[model samples]
Target: MSNVKNTVIVITGASSGIGAASAIKLASLGGKVVLAARNEEKLKALVAEIRNAGGEASYFVTNVTDKTSLVGLVEFAIKQYGRIDSLVNNAGLMLFSDWKDVVVDDWEKMIDTNIKGYLYAIAAALPQMLEQGHGKILNMSSVAGLHVGGSSGVYSATKFFIRGITESLRKEVGVDSGVQVSMISPGVIDTGWADKVSDAKGREAAKALNEIAITPEQVADAVAYALDQPTNLTINDIVIHPTKQDW
Candidate 1:
């Protein structure tokens, strides 16, 4: 594993879940971290916590859906840290709606935030990474991307796109630019993503299932493993799930 010292990492959705945990873990390992998300208060709190612990950190109010906001985030990181070594595109949403009852608005929101957000982040970071000739991009995917299930058609489709894009980028970039692209597919995570489930039965089921979900910190650890790899090494994909999860 490479030392985290002096590494500059930019993370989206850094206010909570895997993003927040990854920020803290990377900082603790001596990496300078930039936290980007729409929640200003939460981002500030996380930044303060890292600083108090003697780690370098900063916060930028970023809405991943907005391309300009993403551009600003990349610029902020460069201005603050000199160079960005990695980007964790972790912002996403999961809405529980059966295809029969799906609302077009909700479907669009899921597609935009879960899929387009990743693309925008890549679009903003790639130019800088290409110029640097070395970078790592970690994307947050879900097991739903691999398996189709009830009430997750649209959400799973978005994740499937994530998986495809990450793999395609990996091949396109190759080892020439020293850029590594990978995806982490987690199942049954204990994040508050289930809180977005509005259907009464689906909400209850999701809550019960999440009772056995893995902690966000666990996923963060996986991300740290990928980042810690030597420049010559690349982890193409990681699939993580609670041991008890059957599907």
Candidate 2:
């Protein structure tokens, strides 16, 4: 893997789960990581932990769904480190429910965060990356994007959207620009997501699925792999999961 030493990486959703894991891993590798999330306490604590561990780190409270918030995040990172080397569009929501439940609110929440959030982050970071003549953009996705599952149509659809745009951005922009656009689709990660599921039946299924899930750190390994490649070699996509996971 390429060295991320001094590379400025801004990660959304950095308060927990995959986002938090990536920030730690990248920073440990010498990357100057900027953590962005709405939780000030968690973000502050994480920044201190990374600094105490002798790594460069910073925090910015950001709401990914809001374009202005994302713009501010990019500015904060640049002000801290001068330029953005990568942007991890990891801020997302996954609320599962059957179509019959008509959980419009949950579905909208997923769309707003999972879809719009990613796009907004990209919009805020891509320009800086392009201007610098090189950068990496890793979109956190899921296996559900490749295969729809029961009670997760909306969530799955949002991931599908991620896959589609990642590919398009790679072809339309990445081919000519120095930026690398990639996606990492993880399967059944044990990120305490099951505990957050609001749907009754969906929560039960999620907990059962968690029995076979892998850790977010495992997914972070995949992320570091994808981001640490030379701009000449693009790691387009990676699908990571537990070996026991059937689908």
Candidate 3:
């Protein structure tokens, strides 16, 4: 729990953005990373890249929205590394539109990916961590979770769900179960998250905000810091944003 060297960490949403950045960073620190995402090709490529860098890694094609898929991911990680020391629930979708727009499909996608996905991953990983007696659960949330904003009501709600889960789980398992739970809520980051916005207005708004966004690597560095802490220390929550981001 204290060292990253040889620790087996499972990361969902590992295809790109924060997940990919964190995977590369964690692997570089001598952790054995198990990458999972719906994109098998990207996962394979990332695994190859990690190996090329002299780091241990593997991949499992998975959809976090599916409980069975999450279960399979945990099983694959165990098969690859014998045990899991931490899990990074980073798979999420951000679709912004006014409630009046009734972008029901986008709403469902965010709920499934941002909310249900974390629930499924938690259900699958918590038991294994319990059995191991020491583990960490790192969640990726958003600053939106803290405050509602224009055209992002539903997206913000989903992130709020993540915040609630992270906090509740921290209390549920903190120290007593030897499990550490953390939430990293980041502001606008220059990732593909904006591409998921369906409405022109929403996309334009996100684009404008992204003008002062941070990089996924910066968020990955925060993740690395949280995981690098000693066993007795647990970084409960982190809120990171670009210096120019006023809201």
Candidate 4:
């Protein structure tokens, strides 16, 4: 893989899971990482861990659902490091409940956090990328985006929206812009996503599946793969699943 030394990377939801894993991995490779998330303590701890390991890192306590907060995150990166070479839109919500039993508030929360938040992050980063004429946007989608299952309709819809948005943005940016957009769709990642499920049975099922799930670092490696590609190369979509996962 190409060394991204001196590149500035911003990752949302960097307090934990794939976001945190990606930040550490990228920073370890000499990239300057700006971690964004709502959990200030977690973000601080992660920043210290990276810095202690001889990596360049910082933290921005941000709420992805807030447009202004996202803009601030982008601006902070530029002001702190002079440029943003990459953005990892990894903040998301996966609340699962039967369609009939789904609360409207819960549905809205999923839409706002999982879908709108992704869009806001792109909006925050795209302007700078366009001005620079070169950048990479890596969005975290899921296999749920491509398929349907019980109690996952709303969550799946949000991911499907992510895939569609990433594709549309990729085409819109086109060749001259030097702004590449890609989506990573992972199956049964060992994250805390299952904790969001409201249905006990669904939560248990997800936990059971994740028992043999792929590690967050695995997804992080895929993100680095997309980012390390030549400017002319855009990996439109990547779907990664554990060997034991049939779906």
TM-score of each: 0.97, 0.98, 0.98, 0.96
For lDDT, candidate 2 versus 4, the one ahead is 2
Per-candidate local distance difference test: 0.90, 0.91, 0.91, 0.89
Q: How well is each residue in 91-200 modelled by candidate 1, as lDDT tens digits? A: 99887776777577878888889988999999999989999998999999999999977777888999999999998899887467779998899999988978888766
lDDT of 2 by residue, 34-88 (tens): 9999999999999999999999999999998799999999999889889999999
Give the higher-lDDT candidate: 1 or 3. 3
> Which of the two candidates, 2 or 3, achieves a greater TM-score against the reference?
2
TM for candidate 1 is 0.97
Q: For this target, which candidate reaches the highest TM-score against the unseen true structure?
A: 2
Pairs clashing in candidate 1?
none
Candidate with the larger TM-score of 2 and 4:
2
Q: CA shift at 73, candidate 2, in angstroms?
A: 0.2
Clashes within 3 Å, all models in order = 0, 0, 0, 0
Candidate 1 residue runs with Cα over 4 Å from true position: none
lDDT of 3 by residue, 40-134 (tens): 89998999999999999999999998999999999999887888999999998887788888999988998999988999999999999999899
